[model samples]
Target: MTDLRDVTLRDGLQLTGKPLPTARKVAVVRELLDAGVPSVEIGSMARPDLVPPLADTLDLIRALDPDELARCWVWVATPRHVERAAEAGAVNFQYCLSASDAHNRANIGRSTEDSLAAMPRAVAAASAAGGRIQLCIATSFTCPFEGAVPEERVLAIARDPRAEGARDIVLCDTLGQAVPTQVTSLVARVAAEMPPRRIVYHGHDTWGLGVANTLAALAAGASEVDGALGGLGGCPFAPGASGNASTEDLLFALRPSWLTPSSFARIVRLSGALLDELGEPNRSRAAQGARTSATAFPWALGAEVSCR
Candidate 1:
C-alpha cells in the first residue's frame, strides 16, 4: 500500500494567518486517522515568535493524548522542536533543511551550505533522542528566485542525509514548479542513490499538477507521498505560491492505484467536515462533486484517476 502523510496542520495553515485552535487541530487529527491516513505533519519547529499562528504548537503538543491518534503517526521539525514534541508524546519526527540557496536564505536565514553543514548535527540530535528522522529537502524543484534547480544539487543533499543515517528523505516541490517528467526522473535517480523505502514525494499544487507529479513519482517507485487536508497550504516564506496537494484530492485521485474507493471516500468526508468547521471552504474535487450532485458524494469510486 502507498503511504500517505497529511500536512494540513503544518503547511496548510501557515499562510492563512489563523492558527487552528488546539481542540480543532486535535479533532482534525482524529478525523484523519479515522479516514485511514497513516501519518500527519502537524506543525513546525520554527521560532513561535516568527510564526505566531503556530505559537500554540507546543501547547497543542502538550495536551495531545496519545490515544487520540493511536493508529496514526504525527511529525514535527528541529532538535528542540523534537524534544518538545517528545514531551508532548509525538511518535515521529521530520527534520527539514533547505536545498535551494535562495530559499534557504529567505526561509531559515542561512545559506544552502550552512544548512547542509547543520544536517549531521540535527540528525545526531534526533537520533540521540530516539526518534525517527525524516529529512525534508525543501525546494527540490524549481525555486522562485533561482529557477530550475540542478538535479545534481538535490541528489547530493539526499545522498548526504542518507549517508548520515537518515532513514527517510522527502523531496519537496516547494513552489509546485515540477512537471511529471521531472518528478519521475528525480525519483528514479534518488531511488538508485538510496534505499527505495526511504524516498517520498512532497508536492505543491500551484500549477495544478500536484496529483500528476505525485503519480509520476509513485510510478517511478516512490512509496510515500505528502499532502494537506483540503488543498490548504502555502509557503509563508515563499512569496506568491500555492498550497500543497489536497489530502482528499490526492487520495481521491490515487484510490484506484493505492486504496479502495470506500476507503478514500471516507477520508474525504471526514476531511471535508473538519474543513467546514475551520471556516475554510473546501477545495477538494470530491467535496466539489458532492456540492454539485449527491451521486458524487462517493466520487472516488468512479472518479477518473488519470494524470493531467
Candidate 2:
C-alpha cells in the first residue's frame, strides 16, 4: 500500500498572506486524522519573519492530542528548528534542500552546497533528539530560476540525506514543471541508488502535471506521495510556483485501491469546508468542477451521487 502524507498545515499555509488560527489548525489536524490519513506535516519551525503563518508552530504542536502528536511531522530548516521541534514533541522532521543553487539562494538565502553541508548536522541533531528525518530535494525536476536540473545534481545531493539517516527522501517538483517521462527517468535513477520504498513524490499543479507526475513516480516504484488538502500550497520563494497536488483529487484518482469511494468523498467535503473557513479559494480542479456542475444544473439530480 502507498502511504500518503498530508502537508496542508505546513506548506499549504506557507505562502498564504494570512495565518491560520491555532484552533482552526488543530481542527484541521483532527479532521485529517479522522479521514484515515496516516501522516500529516503539521507545521514548520522556520523564521517567524520569513514564514509568518507558522509563527505559532510550538503552540500548534502543543495543541495536538497526545495520539495525534505522535503522528505529526514538522519542517526543520536548521538545527535550531529541529531542536525546537523535538522539544515540542515532534518526532518526525522534514528537511528541504533545493537542487539548484540559484533557487536555493533565493529560497533559503544560501547556496545549494551550503544547504547540503548543513544537512548532516541538522539530521544528526534531530536523530540525537529521537526524531525521524525525511529529506525533501526541492526543484528536483526544474528550477524556476535555473531551469532544468540535471539528474546527477539531484542524485549527488540525495546521497547526503541518505547518509545522514533520513528515513524518507522526497523528490519535489518545486516549480511544477515536471512531466511523466522526466519523473519516471529521475525516479528510476534515484531508485537505483536507494530503496524505492523510501522514495516519496511531492508535486505541484502549476503546469497541471502534478497528478500525472505522482502516478508516474508510483509506476516508477515510489512507495509514498505528498499532497495538500484542497490543493492549498506553494513555495513563496519559488517563482511561478502553485499549490501542491490536491489530496481530494489524488484520493479520487486512487479510488478503490488505497482509498475507498466513501472516504474520498468525505475528504472532498472536509477540504471544501476547511478552505471555505480559511477564506481561501479551493484550488482543487476536481472540487471546483464538481461545485460548478452542481450549481449549473441545480435540479438535475434526485438523490446523492455516490462516488462508489
TM-score of each: 0.88, 0.90
lDDT of 1 by residue, 1-308 (tens): 68888888888877775457887877777767666677777776677777766667666665666764333334443456666766666656677777779888888777877766766666666667666677778889888788889999898888774336567778889999899999999989988877644788999989998889998998898888988877878887887678888887777666635455666666667767767766776677655664567675544365563442
Using TM-score as the measure, the top candidate is 2
Q: Count the clashes in each prediction.
A: 0, 0
Model 2 spans with C-alpha error above 4 angstroms: 256-258, 289-308
Estimate every model's Cα lDDT from 0 to 1: 0.74, 0.81
Ten-residue segment with the worst summed lDDT in candidate 2?
296-305
Superposition TM-score, candidate 1 onto the true structure: 0.88
Give the residue spans of candidate 1 off by over 4 A.
67-77, 161-163, 256-266, 296-308
Which 10-residue window of candidate 1 scores lowest in summed lDDT?
Answer: 69-78
Return the top candidate by lDDT. Answer: 2
